[model samples]
Target: MEQPHFKSWPDVAPTLIAVAAGRAPADTVIRGGQWVNVHTREILPDHDIAIAQGRVAFVGPDASHCIGEGTEIIEADGRFMIPGLCDGHMHIESGMLTPAEFARAVIPHGTTSMFTDPHEIANVLGLDGVRMMHDEALMQPVNIFTQMPSCAPSAPGLETTGYEITPDDVAEAMTWPGIIGLGEMMNFPGVIHADPKMLAEIAATQRAGKTVGGHYASPDLGPDFAAYVAGGPADDHEGTCEADAIARVRQGMRSMMRLGSAWYDVETQITAVTEKGLDPRNFILCTDDSHSGTLVNDGHMNRVLRHAISCGCDPLIALQMATINTATHFGLEREIGSITPGRRADIILTSNLTDLPIEHVIARGKTVAMDGKVMVDCPHLDWPDHARRTVNLGPARRAEDFVITAPEGANRVTANVIGVVENQAPTKALTADLDVIDGAVAGDADKDICQIALVERHLGTGKTVNGFVSGFGYTGDMAIASSVAHDSHHMIVVGTSRDDMAKAANRLGEVGGGITVFKDGQEIAMVELPIAGLMSDSPVSEVAAKAQDMVDAMAACGCHLNNAYMQHSLLALVVIPELRISDLGLVDVTKFELTDVIKGSA
Candidate 1:
């Protein structure tokens, strides 16, 4: 049997018209519900909806006339009938699950639409990698729109990706059926300075009539920001404050407030809509990244909506932010974002607006989930052998390979460290004085400082650049290693013991690619992400369980930061702010230059 999808209004319009006029029977009829109309911002009582051929045909005070012997009737019983939730922006790979598994996980939570950026896979596999993601996403029962990745290195010249995306790639991707637009342009400096590659990608997207995403990570809303806006990104999800949200909307960019597994940015920016007088239409909600554990335990867009409502946003307004506003932004308002006639029959039933318990979910006129359990099958593609062998650790390692050699005969030195900020994407550039032992600079776990290294993974260089990081609060002879490093997709290993670090890195190499934790020279937990070294094609529940074990391992090592694995993966993202590690070395992102990890050593 074929998976059902919306075939556009024209393909089903005649049937829809016949069903509404009682000349043909509806496939399904939902009766006696409180219609939560997002377009009019009203909750009208005793409404009915008739669905046929996966599209809405009639929505009025009564739809009983369209029901026949073959129609499936759902008695809403006064439950609130709202349009299915939509995620304005996200990355499917961040969940550590492929598109099929991700769809299965979120269907129970009533997320019917997702606008995803596959930049993580793009950094590891280039244009072909994006195409693979697109094809699998189209196979899902939900709407999973892919955005062509715009930046592979994220910050060119600072790091090298496995494969770079070209303007020709952008032009070619625009023709794909599932390609919604260009992904987040992380090279704000390039855009502001008029870099040819950045402008060309933007121009190609605009010429193809697609949306261009934005990522202005800087706090500055100055002329540089104006230039970036002029360079043409239609929306931004990197805003961290009320001012940032206001500034983006003022410059005609949609301000997307995100609440991912690690990023809790909604409360600060929702003030732009809840308190300030900005039009709510320009404010949107998203989850830039959510690991499997978060998606399984907490929720998806439903969690974000509950958070927004708790933060003083009206329920209707919050739903609009996640629904019609996102739909209208992607130019998809006519198709999937609402419960109006001519739109796909995607909806959710909930008893309360505040708590938002997802009671039932319908997509493409079919009941996919009921009471927190998915009833439909989400399928996966058969991955080839090459896709499972992305982690390329070049050579054998020793404890000495993880060592950061200090200056000749030095006892102590001041070193620049990457400081983790809890629940945020930005890191602080910090400095700490550390002890030197046997001509090697050693991290003091007592001071919450540990050795951080970025290993060259893609091209099989045995090179590793070592630095220091704080805020994990790790103790004992423990190490945490991952191949899911952001943007550049390198190997990041952080540990208090050099031997354990070497062990963790080697284990990832042995498994092809994954995350691992080691302590007392034994493996404590592991999650194997063999696909592009970034995702697992396993069930989301299995992955989330292992992820929970990973969380427990991090906590057992005496490290406690909310979603520390997310912070661990982002240590290699050099485009965001302050300090980061790349294949080159420690990057002072504010200055956009590479500097010595040891203070004054340069």
Candidate 2:
């Protein structure tokens, strides 16, 4: 079914004016609620909101004049009425669900608007994939704006994607409906060094009068950062410290502090607002990459808001950061992010401000969710079979395919290992001494080191780049493989035994695409993400259940890093520092170049 198209303020001004003047009765009246006015940053008690033609007609001390016999009355009972929450930056595919399923999952959590980047699918299927995501987003009950993906390989020359997004692609996408802006420019160095393609994409977005999303992953706050800020991106979410937040805000860029499944970056950077006296309006709350389990069990933007409050932010201020501040960043404040006249009647009814219990949610003057349940259907797209079958790991992989051959005569070798940092996106570059067994480097389980391989899944190359990773705490003959590897969407297989690694890789291929875990030659757990090998077509509840089981299986194998699955998928991400594996080889992201895994052999 087609969702209602949002009417412009001019188109609905007549009806809204009629209802406000009591010349015509309103369609709905929410009475006896405290208006949490974000514009004034104060709560006004005993206000009545009148809605007409899916837009807020009036919000004042009383709406009795606008009410008639046919008007539907909802008694707010003195509850706090705030604008529906908005996520400034997120990737819907990260939730392991389609756009429709993601909206269905978060509507009950009070998130009525989202600015999402479909770059995950773009890496797998290119421009066609982005169009599919945009088409589905337009059919949702709540706001789901699509940002044309800016970086597919994330960093050209550093990584390879199944499809490359060109400047022409960005220009064409800007003309499409629902294209809010260009997605996060993950190639910080490219923008800093003035790469022609990156600049052209930003130029296209600016020419279209759209915001450009930023992702400066580097820790440097020097001239390079200054150059990047001058390149025209408006926001940054890769900040992990107070200094990072302060630097971005000082440069006139909004600092987006994310609290996703594995990235706990809010507590560290929110201090820029809590203690450092930085302007809170310059900060926003978002979930850059949340798993389905986090959305179902914890919350969406609500989770990030609560975390901000716990870190010493005022509840009202936090709400503004999640609502108006976000909408203003995308130039959408007049259309959303407020409980004012001439705005979409997207409001949430909650009893407490601090805890933020979403008792009821109304979107576009219609009650869409009540008592943690969705009242409307989130329409789905008919994804073709070719999109579902994306895991093309040419020719069956074998144990020999994952073997890391040592140098000609080395008995002991110091190898560069990608050290996974818990609750962060950046990895630590560490060195490990491993014994060479029959001219092959072996993983030392006692030392918490495991073999990580990047199997090229996009093209039928059948090439596997092997390296070592630490911090998963795995200590058995277990292996985990996923087609949800970030940026490039290659297959990442980490395991102790080569046999188990091969089994896990083949299992994902056989299942079309998904995450799978194997132990002692037996499949322990799996979650099939048949859509582009990055998301499932199932309901969020079903996906969350399977994800929980996958987490349990990882724990059973002695892997105890919080949300280790996220870490595993990012092992192949070549954009973030300091060490990562890609289809090319071991990459030292800090240097933005592929380096040898064996320290002294190459």
Candidate 3:
């Protein structure tokens, strides 16, 4: 029952105006640049930006008016001075690194702002877990806003979470200093139907005057979609096509296009702007989820921007999408989006607008990254021992835990298999026929069938749900296991060999929590995700190296799907379509009901 110190936008307005009028000594100044003004969608040449006390002061031909003694000046060399990129929606835990490490990984890529939802951790450790992430995010130099996780189990009764988020929790979080809004309301069905709980959360966010994030995973744009919009989510990031983008914007929602480690959605959706010529301001760019490997090896928002350009989006338009569009969506536009007066001094200097190689990065009027490297120290949180020790398998797992028994007297049976779709989150509802061996249903690798298991890791529960999956092209004697399963964050292990699968699963239990790959009952690779059994405390490069080895191990096993590990982990996500598994049982995602894993007919 304590209130935190809060600073509203109006409180900083006076200081900003004083800085702009040259009445205050500028803290930093960037000289001789072409300013990319996203506010008016115009490029102003020969602009000089002056900063004071971590806020933009003046932007004009010359900030000679505000220049004072000892002011640090950065020569832009006539390059494009653009606002630092903002990921409209993302998951820091997906990087398999803590927020500190994730920030260190993306700073060089010029992402100064992020709006993240820690639903994965919420499903694992609940509100305390969310608070850990929220506190750590605030300690960083860049802007990182926490949207109170709207869904813990994701889909109400379809899956059970370690802890459930209540409407009271949502109301309490709205009072937090860092709570920007509600996290993505993944319950599209509940929203459309006006579910009381969902409506209450939205009403709480509205009462607090904050934004509500959206996730309409279904491609259906009919009356249901209209009903969802009427329920009050202001933005959506699940759009994969131009039509999806256009429809969301048409219904008074900002269209968020994402390009994550394995998800290539921006290129397909940005065409709504470049070719079809939809208003670019309504679209925002994000990397929804990127692993540490992708964060270190490739880039963050920079990668999204590059893919947007290849898709024919004008460079400035793409920059705008990554900047002001995101800021405005979160109601932080005047506070930090544009590099204008009365905004946070978050700016990036690039040599070429088209290529966009980030040269200098500044956040809060301080040089944070320079020459493709982080210049400032990204702070870390003091994660307690219990926080890292989250994988709670009641006892050691055994091969017998994976055996699936078919219905009585059934020699062979057809089963509903969760099909892994490469490079996308959704799975296909695939059915496979399998033969019974010794009264137990077995996976048929020759038929491209493999076993999928969801292990209950929260609260020392020994529940394990075993099912089947396909489309990995996996051949003989291999298995993959991950503690990074989506939403619920349980351990999901998939393999052609039961012994290898058990080895991979047991290895994670031994290491506290992490991902492991095995071949013929021998471990080949592992990445230690000790933080809530979902992210690594290790450096991005070290984690990326292990991730690469894990990928290579999957390739050696004859599985040829792109980032198949990501797809495999999502098999238990009951929210996404077709079929999925959870701690309870196999989920018929389409109907949002539990279905028998064994097939009655072909």
Candidate 4:
């Protein structure tokens, strides 16, 4: 089904004027509702809204005059009528589903608008991948604006991508339909150092009057942070603390506090508005990455808004953060993010403000969902077979491919381990002492340490970089592998047994791309993501069910971390802090270079 094209204000002005003046009938009349006016931050009761030509024509104490025989009347029964929720920043591919499936999952949660960055696809398939995502996003019933991916490799010299996006690519994408802005500029060092490529991408977005997303992942609030902000990213979601949020807003940048499936950043940063008295207008709520399970079971923007309220933010203020604040940041305030006249008729009905329950959702004057069930069709693009065949691990990996050799005569050594921080993106730089068995390093399950390997899948390079990671708490002879590794989209296999590790890695290659868990040399659970090895072609419910099973399989193996699969997928994300693994070797993300896994050992 083709989505209704957005009507310009001028095109709908005549009908809107006629409806407001009672000279014409409205297409839909919602009566007996409490309007949540985000502009004035007020909840005025007994309000009525008249919509015409997919836009709000009139909203006031009564719209009875605008109602006619042909008008569809919705009796709200005094429920809170709030503008549809908007995601300030997100990734559709993170849900492990295609754009259509992702929208189907979130629309029931009242998320009518999203500003998405398809950089995940850009890494694996380059500009063609971005265009595919963009075309599909426009076909969805809800507003899904595309931001041309700015960072494919994320950090130029630190990592390698399947395809590289250039300045010309960014410039060309800015002119594409539905292209809102540039994706997150993750290379903070590049921006601070005024790298030509980073600046050129930022300049192109600015020249086209588009917003530039930011990802300054450092905790240092010193000169480097200042220089990065001065380089031109208008918003950031990488802030994890109240101070980080405060600094961003103080420097004229929107501090986007995110609460994805694994990321719990809103609680720590919402205090900036609740306690520190930062203007709520400069603060936005987003889900930088939410898996399919979270979208299907836990809810989307409604989940974030409720969490913010529980963090001591006023209910209406929290709503504003997810709605008007986000829309205004993107310069789309007048077109969306409000229940006022002339804006798109995207609204939600809820009985309570604190524990917000989405009873009904209307997008573009059409009721798309009601009571947790999506009513409208989210159109899908014909994803070709080439997009599905992304994993190309040159040769069959063997148990020997995952081995970590120790120094010639060393019996024990200290190894740099990637420590997974629970509910946060940044990993802790940690070290552990391990014994050498047969000139090979052994993992200590008692200490929550496991072996990690990065298998090169882009160039058919069959290279595996081995390292150690903590915090999975796995104690069995099991392995987990995923091709959804962030930024570079390589394969990350973590396990206690090299045999199981190799089994899991090869299984992913056999399936073209997906996440798989192997226990005792047998597959326990798996989700086949044929689309760029990062997303599935299945329906959202099917993908969510498989993802939930993957989580259960991990827990069954004594691996217990909130969304451990998400942590597993990010092990190769070389841009994040502390430590990571890549095709080259183990990366010291703090230093942005490859370093030895075993310290002080040749």
Per-prediction TM-score to the true structure, in the order listed: 0.99, 0.99, 0.96, 0.99
Candidate with better lDDT, 1 vs 3:
1
Model 2 over residues 122-234: C-alpha lDDT tens digits?
A: 99999999999999999998999999999988978877899999999999999987899999999999999999999999999999999999999999999999999999999
Tens-digit per-residue lDDT, 448-549, candidate 1: 999999988898889898999999999989999999999899999999999999999999999988899998899999999999999999999999999999
Off by over 4 Å in 4: 1-5
Off by over 4 Å in 1: 1-5
State candidate 1's TM-score.
0.99
Q: lDDT value for candidate 3? A: 0.87
Runs in model 3 lying further than 4 Å from the true structure:
1-15
Worst 10 residues of 3 by lDDT: 1-10
Candidate 4 per-residue C-alpha lDDT over 492-529 given as tens digits, one digit per residue, 9 for 90 to 100:
99999999999999999999999999999999999999
